[model samples]
Target chain A: MRARFNSLPPRLKRGLTVFFVLCFAITLADLVVHKHGDHWWNFFGFHSLYGFVACVILVLVAAWMRKPLMRDEDHYD
Target chain B: MINAPFLILFAGAAISWFFPAALRKPVLLIFPVVGLLNLIALDPSQSWTVSLFDVELTLFALDRLSFIFGVLFHIAAIIGLVFAWHVEDRPQHLASLLYPGSALGVVFAGDFLTMFVFWECLALSSVFFITARGTERASRAAIRYLVIQVVSGVLLLTGALFLFHDSGSVAIRALSLDEPAGLFFLLAFGIKAAFPMLHNWLTDAYPEATASGTVFLSAFTTKVAVYALARSFAGLDMLIYIGAVMACFPIFYAVIENDLRRVLGYSMINQIGFMVCGIGIGSELAINGAVAHAFNDVIFKGLLMMSMGAVLFRTGEMRGSELGGLARSMPRTTGLCIVGAASISAFPLFSGFVSKSMVMSALLIEHHEWVWLAMLFASAGVFHHAGIKIPYFAFFAHDSGKRPREAPAHMLIAMSIAAALCIGIGCYPWLLYDNLPFAVDYRPFDIPHVVEQTQLLFFSAMAFIWLQLNGLYPPELKSTNLDSEWLYRRAWPSLYGRLCRIAGWGQARFYEAVGSLTNALAPPLRKQAFLLLMPWSVREMLMILMILLAAILFLLFLHRPL
Candidate 1:
């Protein structure tokens, strides 16, 4: 599914809005709410950022990995 | 519990082979239901022991752990049997019966000896599922699958024998690494659990299985291994790190992997990683999480495999590169697949959310901070690859223009049953929690838990959407990628063939040079060599025999009667 556009689809727009709103809400709550401990990971938005960035890197690295790993379908022959 | 359910399956399997294809369907469909009823009738706290050579072996038993698996396997069997109602392949029907039977046998086995017998039976019975595809690839893959499975069995037997020698007993119980057999048991269970490098057999073979056969294949083998580990290897610290690695590594391979079923295989390993890590934590809640995830995984992963299998059956295509726009025809299958994807992705109200969150919470309680992070990464990656990529490419992507008919009625019934369970488990996890080996004290729907999990998944999906729009997402293509099997399946074999060719050339040249040198240096020597090396005629053979006889007689005469 290849689609190159400058704008997000309406479904994606709505999803992103929910995601951003959640991130903001969690961030505000984390400042006042006493979690089990105050730590870097306990900070809100870490899960979101890590999840997003890790997945992006996962895709890029995996795509680049194909250069070294990929071979002909009949490579065994 | 074990004998009744497994006996029902085994007897039905044997009898099924004799039935004509038309008659086999009823037998295939009825026996698993009977077995389920029988399973439900049994006492959860029960054991049956027998004497063999002055030793006690438990052939049938049930604890909370094995009892749940017994029920799960029966349900999986029923769903699988119903899915294959239209399949006239009797051997697959037989394998389908015995494979789940063997899994239940393993689950209820209270001693090593009984477990080993059914462990090997699991290997032997499941191979036919792959072979039922009857393609060249399927045949070769079946052999490879059999070899790996038998290797796991051999390891199991080796560990059992060692346990017997060290302890003079073979009871299944929690073990520590100090025991002689502990590491062997870990490696054995590790292999079947699809521990990182030992995992290629799963990805290599499952995709090659027959359409409905893969559904049965997905439900039983690795989950039984998980049960074995939870019984024996729970609280082993190394599994935490091993499980973390298992969780993370498959995401890389799965992203660029073209085969849709193979992607799910990787996803299966990823999901198993969560269970393994939870088992390593070994608290009551953690163990509960591990076992619960195992239960949920069988249902959800089976659902996904059935959906893919249905697509394969309808269109004769499995690779993502070759499938798209299937929703136009198979709307029900598409919707069922989305439910599976959502469940596996751990959407808030899906089966995965209820169980998988338990593992994450357990990780925090046990202070496995790094492993917790790894699992979260795996969770996001799973959403990207399995949850989104699977349905997106299979049903919603660039049209490959293949407009095949919808899945048959039986297959839809199977998918709908699984989808309903996914929803049922998600909504009412207490039905599962009350049956756990330990008391359940965790809440999965807490505000922080649900909110954080949703953030992780939604952001992960956002990343996926961004990648797709930017043309950075790896497009599906038909190609082989190097895995651990590359060493043997390709590299070593190629090296051996080259060495053989070189040695053959060198030997031919050496022979030619020797022949020329002999002719040039001494013609008489060459003639003598020819005469000695020439093929013998019948007269020459007789003459040689006579000479040998005369020499023996002379020697005997010289020695006399001494």
Candidate 2:
């Protein structure tokens, strides 16, 4: 699954991923708006979503770095 | 009073230097016995005096506060000696003596200067324990530990100098926490006590020490700082917030930590948080709680360290990922470890319950509702990690097929002694509470209080179960979870590395420019300068002769004219 995902073309991969993420986030935001009040809830929700996406990107970069550099437990010892 | 403690320390160091390797461990055990005897015999009221640097010294004054901490320190030393009885290293043996002796000196010293002297001694001596591991990690940790410890001591010295200038008194007694010097002194103590952000050194360094060395390290530095804080900054308002945060931050880290020793390290800071918060409250009840919890924490926390130390010693492994199913083979150690976990988690009828409840209850009665709530959350978090996670992963998690034998007799004895103390104090709270520096009005064992505590603990345990069973909790894995130390350890190192590279590049460019300029100018400048001075001696000689003749004629003319 990971290899297949990695094999996708960069532009198609980028567009589809962003479109899905936006849809999911908007749905989640709408659900929150339905349950809670609008102004403060929308404000916090959008900021949190942005932060989450950033964190995910960072994690992906970290994962990429880790692939080659990772060592077994007794590496130094 | 003075003879045995200092003598035993010197004697231990001397024996370690001269004695056979086989005899050193036994001698290490002997020092603590002699020190404990000296400690138990001292009277707080009848202090023996020595004069130093125009200040009166009470080398063995057992103040109410000092007496309790002194006894605990003595007990911790004895327990640590037993735990490390199998260790053969001469440096470790020497360090074991000096570490506690320095703490004893700090506890008993009558003046700030005396305390500062021992305070620095404690820092200098404890580094050996970390350094003895002889690993790169240990070496790095030791350096960081030494730097922080020395910084604390320097701050203490600075505070002491300022204090002397302001108060014209050298006596180490209670002071208002508002003064600049007082804040410095409090920070010095706070760093050692693992006060929130000031804490990283404890967790960063302890896990890197030799397994046995860690047990000794865990007890003294922070508790001594707690003693200092209780003495100086009790009732300081900021401590409440600092302590609350201290209690909270370690839980997440501990939950995800694979190294059981490092997990215990985080737990150590969490336990200290309770004590600090108690000190902040500063009521008789709160102070009593702080002192009592400090006592209980040393025993149970040391017991936990001893258990983990045993595992590390036997397998040379401490990470939870590499450990599991030891209970099948090492049931005694597992049981003991469970006892420690229970005590730390404040399980009802355990030591943590008796002591920690006092601090929590004090917060409520004082009407600091938010702090009370935070303490409650931290309390549950403590159970989530130190109480359950430690024992679960180390003893009874996924079977790793490792049939490690039980700990050595001496290590077991050490752990049993600490475990027994945990139970003893829990069963009889009056024994601990009555001996606290302040009078105790808070009762720990009312029916309603007991029920409420039980419910809170049971439900938190239930929450832990839910999290674990549902796979919602963070799993312990083989990875380094970053802590505040990352600011200096990782981030600053990378920053410094970048800066050094830039500077190197700049230097290379500058040197290249200078080299080219020097190469271009060298031949012409050298030739021209030499050529300007290349006159023949004959030409100069004739000119000099003519000038001499002219001077003589001119002299004759001037004489005739006159």
Candidate 3:
């Protein structure tokens, strides 16, 4: 993931990478408190961990969609 | 006497359709003046009813409530027509006539069915005003508005049917609050009156209309709904809650809205909230308060719309982000807009102060403590957004360096007339009160009431000032905020798209299955039919022919016996 990020355009990629790291850290902290309901590895199994993963997925999906349909601010009026 | 006002209005509308533009405005202006004369000339002490198509159309009831609303309607119509005098379209002028005529019909109708007809008329006529704006957005918004309004009419008709079933009479009068059907009718009125979440149509479409067109749009529909709600649903307990919520919810949104006209639209909803709560309390004072507030709101709100209409007319910009420091050039319009904003904010000695307080007092007397608090907060909210935001953004906010000229003389004259009415009614509350359906026992100028309102509003203004200086208040942003309209605007569209996609896939699969089935059945069906007619089956056919020959011989044997 670090290698993939370092190869991309710096500003936008840096912004997304920071966002992903913050989200991942928040999930890790939440799972530490929640303890994933029962297990020692529960932090990795928590819903927020999945949520962070979903955020990353959505970011990639959104980027893909934006290429085709993204528009100028004055598109409508 | 009752039909006189409507007849005048209808005649004006009919003439406008055929009359040249030179004659239309003057002719339209004359209709409302004649209506004003008819209204003033009506005998307040007597009730007169006329029958049309075997239906009793109460013409001049002169009940205090109808008198207040009717008189206000006449005045508003006159002011609105004059404000839009520069509009050259014949159909629009014709529509303007029909709109008010229908409102008068609703106001004066003696029966539910009569009211329903006028109710539907109001919906049908007002669409033209929006459509006349001639913008794609305006046309779309107008259609949405028409659908909501027409749906309200349908609900009203359905309610009327049930009401007739329940009571076996069509005579319109105050109704008992205990029935579901009556409640349905109230919801219908509530929707048109723009009760809270049902309000976005007013803001959405009114701003999108032609500059001159919106002036007429602001006055009639919701106020007429308030008149209906006050007539039928006064004192229904739930109305208090509904009305309280109506008063409170729109201010924050109005405060942040970029579209100045749309902000006024939100403020319109907020103002109606006061009247609705007053109706719910159902005291003579409270109902009077509602009637008075409706009367005041129509004038001042129309004036506000006119001022903004003036701005839009000259500069062609309606959004707050696109307009500022207009006061330097359009000083007259800026002054008039401030008068409107002051009246709306319930500034002490303003029309809002005189009328809106009666509802608040009714709450206090009824011991509705929390509702009263909600109302007071809403009152402050009104001041913060409409009273301040409107004039501030339009006249004095960050200057955009556009120096549009003053509005035309006719527009200023129309606005002045409305502004004068706002002050006239405030200074002499009895002018409105004496005509209410009930006795006028309430006075607006009690010292304690004045002081308290002054303190409340003045302090609220101070809060606004402090917030502005400290950057604590949310600045007006250029984005559309979601309202109840989100259900139709966003949610329903999404749900509809999803349903269409699912149906498309289902149809594709069904067709595919049918195609495969047809391919599978073709050979077998053909073979079976072919086998039945094959040469191998010729012997069976010959046997059948031999059987027929045997039957014929039996018949010949029977004939010999005969």
Candidate DockQ scores, in order: 0.57, 0.03, 0.01
User: Residue by residue across B1-562, what tens digits does model 3's lDDT show?
Assistant: 4345677898888866777888878988988898888777777676657676644556535565677778888888888888888899877888788999899888877777778889999989888889998888888899999999998998888888787777766777777657657877887897899877778788878888888778778889998899888888789888888889888777766766778999889888888889889999999889888888888899899999999999999998887888899999999999999999989988776888888988988897888878986787787678777888899888988898999999999999999998888888778777777767677777678654554555455555545544544444555456566567778877887887776666667667866997999999998898788676667667888898899999777545433322
Question: Across residues A1-77, which tens digit of lDDT does each residue of candidate 3 receive?
Answer: 34544665688577655754644454444433432123232344233333223223322343344445334423333
Summarize candidate 1's per-residue lDDT along A1-77 as a digit string, tens digits.
23344365778667766866765675465455445544468775676788789899999999999999999877764
- Tell me the spans in candidate 2 whose CA falls farther than 4 Å from its real position: A1-77, B4-7, B15-17, B53-58, B501-562
> What are the per-candidate TM-scores when only chain A is compared?
0.57, 0.37, 0.40
Q: For model 2, how does the per-residue alpha-carbon lDDT over B366-400 read when each residue is reduced to its tens digit?
A: 87878876777677677767888888898987888
Candidate 3 structure, TM-score to reference? 0.80
- The model with the greatest DockQ is 1
Order of the predicted models by DockQ, top scorer first: 1, 2, 3
The residue ranges of model 1 lying beyond 4 angstroms of the native Cα positions read A1-3, A6-37, B1-3, B495-562
Which whole-number lDDT from 0 to 100 does residue B527 have in model 1?
A: 55
In model 1, state the lDDT of residue A34.
46
Docking class of 2: incorrect
lDDT at A8, model 1 = 59
Point out the worst 10-residue segment of candidate 2 chain B by lDDT. B462-471
